[model samples]
Target: MFEAIKLLVGVVSLIMVYRTITGNCNKYLAFAICAIWLRYFLSAFHTITYPSLVAGFSINALGSIGVAGLGLLLIPTAVFTLKKLFPFYVFFTAIAVSGFVNMQIPGTINVLVKWCYFLVLAGALFLSIRCQGQNETFKKLLVAFVMPVSLQMLSIVLGEAKATEADGSTSYIGGYNHEAAFSMIIVSFIFVLGLVNRNAISFRTTLFTVAVVLLVLVNYRTAILTILPIAAIFYFTLVEQRLKPSQKAPVLTIVTMVLAILFFVLSLSMQERFADVGLLVGNLDLIFKAPMYFSDAEQDIMSARVYIWSQYINAFTNADLLHQIFGFGPDSWKHKFDLYAHNTYVSYVYEYGYLGFISFIGLMAYILTASFNLSNKPLGKILAFSLIGFMIMNMATMPLWNIEGLIFFALALGTVFANPSAQKVSKEIGAGHKTSMEIN
Candidate 1:
C-alpha cells in the first residue's frame, strides 16, 4: 500500500514538473520544489522495499537535481538580479574558498551546487511573482505544497516507519528521516497557509492549526516549545487589528506570560534527551565555560550536545591559521567527530570556518532585518515569526542540514528578497480589504 502511494506521488510530481517545463503551469518553481521533495518519498519507498539499494543511494546522489534542472531551464525567463541575493553570493563564495583551501573540492562542490539550485528556485519565484502577481502565484504555491504535504501527513498517520527515541518513545516520522524534520515541514506549511489566509481566520485554518499542533506534540515534543509561542503570536497578530490599541498591549502581555509558564511546564514533560531541559538550564554556567573545563557528568547534559559542541569548538580553536579561517570543509564533522554537532552555530563554524560562519550569520541578519522592516505586511509577519521559530529550532538541531529545512529556508528567502516593490502587495491587499469590509 505504501509502495503504491509512493509511486503515485512520484508520477504526479513528475507530471507537475513536465507541466511546469512546458508552460502548462505558471507554478514552475513550485512544482520543481515539489519534485525534489517527492523524490525523497520515492527514495525512502525504494529503500524500504530493497534495503540492498541503500548503499547505491548515497553513491548515485545528485542533490536537488530535479529543481536544479528546471531552475536552469527557466533562467532566461527570469532576470537574475543579485542585489537582494548579495548575502547568499558572499556566503557561497566563502564556502567555495573554504572547500578549495581544505582540499574537499568534491564535497564542497556538491554543497555549493545544491544551494545554487535553490538560488535558481528563488529567481524563478521572483519571475513568477513579477509576471503573474503575488496573490495568484501564492495560490498556486498553496496547491503545490498541499499536494505533497497531504501525502506526508497520510504517511505520518498510517505508514509503517517509526522513529524510536532513547527513552523508548516512538515518533511517527512519516517520510522524513527525523521527527523534527517532518515537523519542520508541517510548521512551514502552516505559516504559508496562514499567509494565504491572511484576510481573515476561517474554520479550515483553525482546524488545520489544531491538527498540526497535535501532530507536533505527539511526534516531536521539543518542537512544540517553539511552535506554541509562534502560534500564539500569530493568533494575536491576526486579531490585533480588531482590538483597540488600549486592549492590545494588555492582551498580548497576559497571553505571553501565560504561554511562557505553560511552555516551561511542558518542557519538563518531554521524553529522553528533551527531558534534560531542566538539567540544561541548571548547567548554564558550565555551558559558557571553556570546553576543556567541562566535567564528564556535566558533558552528558542536553543529550551530550554540550560535549559535542565543546569538541567542535575546541577543534576549531586548536586548528592552524588557514584551517581556522576557512574551516575543515563542508560536512567535516563526518570525519572529525563521532557525532554530528547538534548545534547549527557550532557546526557551521567547524565546517565552513569563521569566514563562512560570518557570511551565513550576515545572511540570517539580512532576512531578520528585512522581515522586521515589512512587519506591517501580512506575509512579512509570517516570515518573521516562522524565521524566528526556525532559528530557535536550530540552536538544538541542524535544520539546514536536511533538504526539508532548506526547502523552507529557500521559500522564506525567495519570498522576502525576490521582490522589493510592495506596490503590488499593497494594491491587492487594499482591494481585498475593501471587498471584505463591504461584505462584513
Candidate 2:
C-alpha cells in the first residue's frame, strides 16, 4: 500500500514538473514537485537495504520509469519550444535517436534509459539557449527550477551526517552522497545563470557562497576539483570585469591560498585526536605521493582506469561485423562486468561501437557550436561553459547516468535553451543591446 502511494506521488510530481516546464501553470509548482521528489527519493533509498525487493524491483523499475518520464517531458518541451532559436535541436534529436537504436539491443535497457535521459537533457539545453533572449523574468524562472533541487541536496547532507553520527555507518539512501555531488554541479550552473542575468547579483552571490560551503562540507574531492577551473574561468571572464580598479584580485587569491594552507596544517596538527581528519590528511598524502609510490602501490589508479578502458575497447573490437555496426543491445555490458563501463567514452564505444560513437560526438559538437555562436548572451555563454565543464567531469565520473544528475542537467539546459514567445519583448524593453554584445 505504501509503495503504491509512493509511486502515485512520483507520477503526480513529475506531471507538475512537466506542466511547469511547459509554462502551463505557476512555475513554483514544478519547484515544489522536484523538492518533494528529491527528499522522498533520498529518504526511501536510505531506509531500503541493498539487493532487497525495494531496491532491485520497485525502486529500480518503477522509480526509473518515473524519472525517465520526467526527462522525456522536459526534453521535448525544450526542443519544440526552442526549435527556431536553436536549430541544433534537430542534430541533438538525431543523435538521441541513433543512440536509442544502438541501445535497443537485448539486455541493454539500462544503457538505453541512460541515453534517453541524456538526450532529453541535451534537448533541454538547446531550449535554454533559445530562452536566454527572453526577459529577466524567464531567467529568474530558470533559477527557480534549480533552487529546490539545491535545497534538497543540503537536506540530504544534514540528514546523512546525523545518520552517520548515530550509527557509525555510511548510508546513501537514494544515492545521496553522489546526489550531493551532482547538486553541487547543478548549483554551479545556477550560479553561472545568475551571473549572466545580472538582475539578481545579490541572490546569485549568496547562492554561490552557499554552494561553495556545502561543497566543502560534503568533501567530495573530485567535485571540488572539477568546479575549481570553471569557477576560475567565470571569475576572470565575468566577475573580474565588474570589480572596481581598486579591488585587488591578487589579494583575494593569496588569502584563499593562505587559508587553504592553514586549514591543511591545522587538520594535520589535530591528527592524534581526530581520526577522521587524520584519515583525510593521510589520503591526501597518498594522493600526492602517488608518483613516488606508483611501483609499490597495490592499487594503481591510473593503471586500473587504463586496464578497464582496454577491456572495454577490446570487447567492442572483438564483436562481429553486425554487432560492430549496430552494437550489442542495451545493458549488454552487464553480461560481462555486471555494471556500466564507468567512463562515458568507453560506455558509448562499448554500447554503440564506432558508428554510434561518431553520431553521439557529432550531436554534442553541434550543440556546443551553436551555443558558442550564441555567446552574445551572458546566460548562453555561461550555459555553454557549464556544459563543457560537465562533460569533463563525466569522463572520470558516471553520475551522468544517475536520476538526480540527469534531472538537474535537463532543467538547466531547458532554462538556457528555452524558446521564448517574446523576442520582440526584449527589443521593446531596450534589452536588445545586452543580447547583441560580443562575449569577449
Candidate 3:
C-alpha cells in the first residue's frame, strides 16, 4: 500500500517534468530541484520503512539514475560555468584531487561520483533559472519542496514510529532513517516557507508549523533550539510590523511571557532526556582540549560524540603529511572506526584532509557571506536564516554528509542567487559586456 503511494508521487512529479519539457509549463528549473527532493523522499522512505537491504540499495541507485538522467535532459536548456561559481568550483576541485589521490580506495571513488552527480544537478538548476525568470522558477521550487515534504511529514501521524531511544521512547522519524535527519529536513522546510511568506502566517501555515514543532519535541529535542530563530523571524513578521511604536513593547512582553510559559512546560516534559544535553553543556570546556586527555566519563558524554570526535581528530593529527593534507579518502571514517564522526568539521577534516576541509569551509563561508548580504531584502532574509540554521545543524550532525543536507544547501543557495538583486547584477554585467562588444 505504501509502495503504491510512493509510486503515485513519483509519477505525478514526472508528469510535471514532462509538461515542463513540452513547454506546457516553463518551470523547468523548479522541476529540477523537485527531482532531487523527490529522489531523497523516495529513497529515504523505502530504506527506513522496509527491512530489505537489497531493495533499499536498488531504490537509492534508481533514484540516483533518475536525478542524473533528468539533469542531463535539462542541462542543455541552460548554460553555466564552474569557474564563475567560485565556492563550489574550489570545493569541487579539492574533492576531485583527493579522489584522484585515493583512486584505489572504493569509498573515495564512491564519494567522488556522488559529488559529481550533485554538482551536475546543481548546475542544471542554475541553468534552468537563467532560462526562466528567477521569481517564477523559485515559486515553483517552493511548491515542489513544500508539497512533497508535507506528504512525508504526514507519516508522523499515519505511520508507526520505532524505538530510537534506550528509554524505550518512540521516535517519530516520519519514515526517514534517523530522527535527527528527519527533523533537519522538516525544520529547514518550515524555515524556507516562513522566509518566503514572511509577511504573515496563514491559519494553515500555523497549523502545519505547530504539528512540526510537536514532532520535533518528541523526536529530536535539540532541534527545538534550531526552531527558535524561525519562531523569532515569524514573530517579527506577524507582530512587529503591524504594531505601533508604543504598542510594540507591550505586545512583545506578552508574547515573551507566553512563550516562556510554553517553553517551561516543554522542558518539564523532557527533563529526563535533557539530562544528557545538560551534561554536554556542563562539559563544554572539554571540547577545546585534546581528545587524548578525556577521561572515560568525559568520553561517554553526549552519546559518546566527544570520544568519537576526539578519535577522528587524533587520527588526522597522527597521520603522515600526505594523508594529513588530503585526508584518508571519502568515508574513510568507515574504514577506521565503528561509528560516524557525528561532527561535520571532524568528518570533513578526517575524510577529505586539510585541503578538502578548507575548501569545504571556504565554500560554506562564501555561501554565508552571500546570504548575509541578502538579509536586506524580504526573500533574501529567508535565505540568510536558512543558511544560518543549516550551519548550526552541522555543529553536531553531518547535514552536508548526506543527500538531505545537500538538498538544503542547493535549495537555500540556489534561491539566494536567484533573488532579483543577484540576477539584476548579472544582467547589468552582461549588458555592459554587450555594449563593449558593439563599440569594438
Candidate 4:
C-alpha cells in the first residue's frame, strides 16, 4: 500500500515535470509545483521511505532526465551570460567553495544534490526575471501557487487530529511540513490580490483569505508572529488607503467577523497556550524571564527557542576556524544538535559562515529595495509591501536564500528588478547598482 502511494506521488511529480519540460507549463507554475510538490516525489523515493534501491535510482534518473529536457526547451532564451547571472554565480560558487573547505562536509553527496537544487531554482529566478509581463502566464502561476497549497493545508486539517487526554486540547499537525513557506505564499497572495482591487476585499479574496487563515490557525506554528506582520503590512500597504464612503461599513463587518472567527477557533484549540500567554499579562517577570519557560513546552513552542538558540551558539563558538568560517556543509546540524539550527544566525554562520551569511543579508536588502521600485505601479507597491513582510518573517526563520519558499520571492524580485522602469536590467545581478533613496 505504501509503495503504491509512493509510486502515485512519483507519477504526479513526473507529469508536472514533463509538462514543464514541454512548452505546456507556465514558468511560475513550474516553480510552484517544484516548491510545493517535487520534494514529496523525492521523499517517496528516499531510502528511508522506500526500501527498494531500484525505485530510488529510477526516480532520481527520471528527475534528471526531466531537468535536461527543460534545458533543451530553454535553448532560445537560454542566452544568459556571466554578467546577467552574477548574483546566482556568486551564490552557488561561494557555497561550493565553502563546502569544499569544510572539514565536516560529511554529507558531500547530499551537499551536491542541494547545490543542484539551488541551481535549478536560481535558474527559474533568472528566467522569470529575464522574461516579464506575461500576464496570462503569471495568472496561471498564481493559481498553481495558491491552489495546491490551499488543498494541501485543508487536507492536513481534515485528517486525523489528536486530543491530549490530559488537556482535551486537539492538535492537528496536518501534512504540511514547510510552515514558514506556506505562510509566505499566503501573505504574498494577499498582497497581490489587494493590489489588484485595492478599494476593498474582493469577494473571492475574502473567501480565499478566510480559508488560508484557518489553515494557519491549524498549523499554528508561525500563527501569532507571522500573522500580525502580514495583517499589518496588508493594512499599511493595501488596506489603509483613503477609503471610499461605501467601503467603510462592509470593511468593518468583514474585519470584525474574520477576527472573531479566528479568535474563537484559536482559543478552542490551544487554550493551554492562551492560558500561559496570560503569563505575559500583569506578570512582567515572564517577559524578562521568558527563557525560563522551557519547562513548559518543546523547542518550537514558547520561549524554547531561547534555550535551543543558546545551545547552537555555544556549539558554534567552540568550533575551529574552518567550521566557524565555512560551516559544516548542508544538513550538518545533526552533528551539532538537531536537524537544523533553530535560529537563522546560528544556521548560516555555522553552515556557510560569513560567505553565506553576507550573501543572505545582501540579497534581502537588494530585493526589498527593488520590490518597492518596480515598473508596474500598483503591482510593484503591492509586491513590495507584501515582500517586506516576508523578509521580516525570514529573518526570524530561514535566511532569505536557504528556504524553498523564498525561491518564489527571489523569482519575484528578479522579475521586479528586470523591469525597465525600476532599473535597467544590469549585466550584473548583485553588482553594486544602488537604488535611489526615494525608491528605498
- Top lDDT prediction, candidate number: 1
Give per-residue CA lDDT, model 3, range 30-104, as digits (tens): 556566566555655665533534633456655665576666666643334534376776776777677678763
* Model 4 RMSD vs true structure: 7.4
lDDT of 1 by residue, 129-200 (tens): 556655555545554454346556666578555655534566654454557666666665665565555553
Model 4, 1-440: lDDT tens digits are 43454365456546645665356564644664455345344433345432434634445434543553463454334433524445655655556767678644545444445444544554554455444333423433444343434444444455544343234444332233344444445544543344344333347356446645654544434334445544544544334355676886778567657766766786677566555434534553432243435454533333344455555566666778877777666556766575454456657666777677787677666666666666556556656655665554553455343334444454455455445454443423357655322211
Q: CA shift at 204, candidate 4, in angstroms?
A: 3.5
lDDT (C-alpha, whole model) for all candidates: 0.65, 0.49, 0.63, 0.50
Best by TM-score: 1
User: Model 3: runs farther than 4 Å from truth?
Assistant: 1-24, 44-57, 76-79, 82-84, 120-139, 142-159, 165-167, 198-204, 214-218, 244-268, 288-296, 420-440
Superposed model 4: Cα runs more than 4 Å off: 1-85, 103-119, 122-134, 143-159, 162-203, 235-303, 399-403, 421-440
- After superposing candidate 1 on the true structure, give the runs of residues whose Cα lies further than 4 Å from its correct spot: 4-33, 36-40, 43-60, 77-79, 145-161, 198-202, 214-218, 244-265, 268-273, 285-296, 419-440
Q: What's the C-alpha lDDT at position 315 in model 4?
A: 65
Give candidates' CA RMSD values in order. Answer: 5.8, 8.5, 5.0, 7.4
The lDDT, on a scale of 0 to 1, for candidate 4 is 0.50
Pairs in steric clash, model 4: 83-427
- Candidate 2 residue-wise lDDT at 170: 35
- The number of clashing residue pairs in model 2 is 21
